[model samples]
Target chain A: MAFEINGKTYETDEEGYLANLSDWNTDVAGRMATEDDCDLSENHWEVIKFLRDYYEEYQIAPAVRVLTKAIGKRLGKDKGNSKYLYELFPYGPAKQACKYAGLPKPTGCV
Target chain B: MKQIDWSSLVINESGKAVKKFMYVNRHAPHGTIYPLEGLEVVLIGAAFDQDVSMAFIGDGVFQLNKGQDTADSGMKNVALTYGALGDYEVTKLYVEQESLDERGLELNDLMNLTWEDEEENWAEKPSIQVVSRAQLSDLLEQQDVILNF
Candidate 1:
């Protein structure tokens, strides 16, 4: 599949941008930083990938409160906790991360 | 391009290339978070520029609450879903003001953040239509396609 962002065309696997989006989870956030073309820090990747997985399962992006604890439980150490999650994505973690992942916005947000 | 008026909680978009949509989130959170249904519509709606309106009524009014807590149950909340609708330039977010007041919620405290400033107070913002039982029945009759969640 091909998608154009900012007028640049890029080819993706059958699952749309899932391959590229999923590759940036916590461990690979930094390595793919240059490739993904986003200056995303690890913290940024943490939230983004979490949101992607959440969206994949439920088919709905989660609000902040859900992002906070879900990350905390899954990654351990609260993964920066609520305050940290807010710092990473002030416009709201799920929304910001989804944009970075090149995925559609989460569903039923608000 | 299937034209669907999705006021109910049924997820009409799955495994397809949706071209037209009518999202109606008529169920409130809590017992009927039905966010999943609305969420599916919102994401798909954001992918195109057709007839897509996420209208809120009845208990579904709570779907727009500012603060939500779904993580405790290991579930993600529905805030971002509302935010992403703008990316696709959703037609408009319709809210029935009467629904909020009836639930003891004020308009200011209820709304998805994605609709901030411009979109939040969009001139085309959802109408807070307060109606009598007679009005609701009449309104239902007027809709070409209606979904009740």
Candidate 2:
């Protein structure tokens, strides 16, 4: 599937994750969140940015447990746990945030 | 409703038994999927918390060569994933010296992989070790299970 923003087209998978990670931009992410009936906030952006940086370094989207631990290390305890992360992305942190971050679904996610 | 200790069903009275599991990789990383698939299996197996290790001989030695850029080739650069193995606690990566010598490669040609020693104040320690073929044979003999790819 594909979506257009101001005459620029972006390809996405059947599940709505961006087909080409490089095609992602703020507009693309915002458009995706809107489709899910979720508004993008500073808190959500923090997790999205973290996921992007992680995929850039690791070449794989991390599982939820790994993401939680890494977030605790880089962000803070208050923002690290599953409860806090779930509050930001209701569909599940790794699955939803990674999609918004233009990453493939995590390797271990069913 | 009662809560059962599920781990008790798997572990005997001797406590959890950790086996020496070795994955021997002898294939190139890009040409086929053996090495990549093997690495994924190794990562999954690590969850068992066994005494896991990997040995690289033959073409497998090339899997560790540095400066792997796959952007132009349109292939995923899984060489970078080797760096993450340390986090899985599969830290012992034994490379055969004879294999490297045959390919005219030196120890420096490989990536510098390391694991942190939580017991030693989280000190970084090298994970890759170059061993003679004979030494590798000895290691193979000691493993409770050996998987080859």
Candidate 3:
């Protein structure tokens, strides 16, 4: 699948994950979110930025359980819980947030 | 059907059986997929909350080499992923000293893998232990299951 913005085409997998992680930018993330009928909010950006930084360090998209714990440690208890994350990305925190973050579907994620 | 306490079966609560799972990585990190596949199994197994450890021997020792630049090679550099093993509770990593010596590698040649001890005020501790061939053999014998890649 592909999406176009400003005359450039962004390729994605069948599941809508970016084909090339390097192709991702804030604009790409914003466009992807818009496709899902979701708006770009500060809360959503926080999780997306966290996932990008995490993938940079670990070279893998963390599972939801791991993401939650790490977010709790870094962000705070209020923003780290599943409820808050789920509210931000309703499809599933790790799976949906990681797609917008331009990472491959998280390892071990169904 | 009755509700099963699955966590009780795998978790090491007192009186519950917890077996030692040793993943022996014996291949290079990039040439073949064995090392990556083995690491994935180790991570999944860690969720069971059993006694888990890993032994890096032969070409496997190269998996922990520091500053791996795979940008031009087209292969993903997964060396950084090893750093997260600590968070998965798979901390015990044994590196065969004989293997390192054969390759002219030193302890500093490998990545500094560590885990935080939540019980001890979150103190950081090293996870890799360099051991001799004999020592690794003895450790291998103690495992309930030894998975070799």
Instruction: Place model 1 in a CAPRI quality band.
Output: incorrect
- Which structure among the candidates has the greatest DockQ? 3
Model 1: per-residue Cα lDDT over B28-79, one tens digit each: 6756557666566555434443345556777777777877767787655655
Ranked candidates, highest DockQ first: 3, 2, 1
In candidate 3, chain A reaches a TM of 0.97
Residue A85, candidate 3: alpha-carbon lDDT: 91
Model 3 vs. true fold: TM:
0.87
Q: What is the interface RMSD of each candidate, in Å?
A: 8.4, 1.9, 1.4
All candidates: TM-score: 0.45, 0.82, 0.87
Task: Give lDDT: candidate 2, residue B101.
Answer: 99
lDDT of 2 by residue, B1-149 (tens): 99875652444245886678999999988999999899878876766667899999999999999999999999988998888776667799999999999999999999999986656865789999999999999999989899998
Task: Report, to 2 decimal places, the DockQ of model 2.
Answer: 0.49
Give the Cα error of residue B87 in candidate 3, in Å. Answer: 2.4
Model 2 sits at a Cα RMSD from the real structure of: 5.4
What is the DockQ (computed on Cα atoms) for candidate 1?
0.11
* Model 2 fnat value: 0.28
* By TM-score: ranked, best first: 3, 2, 1
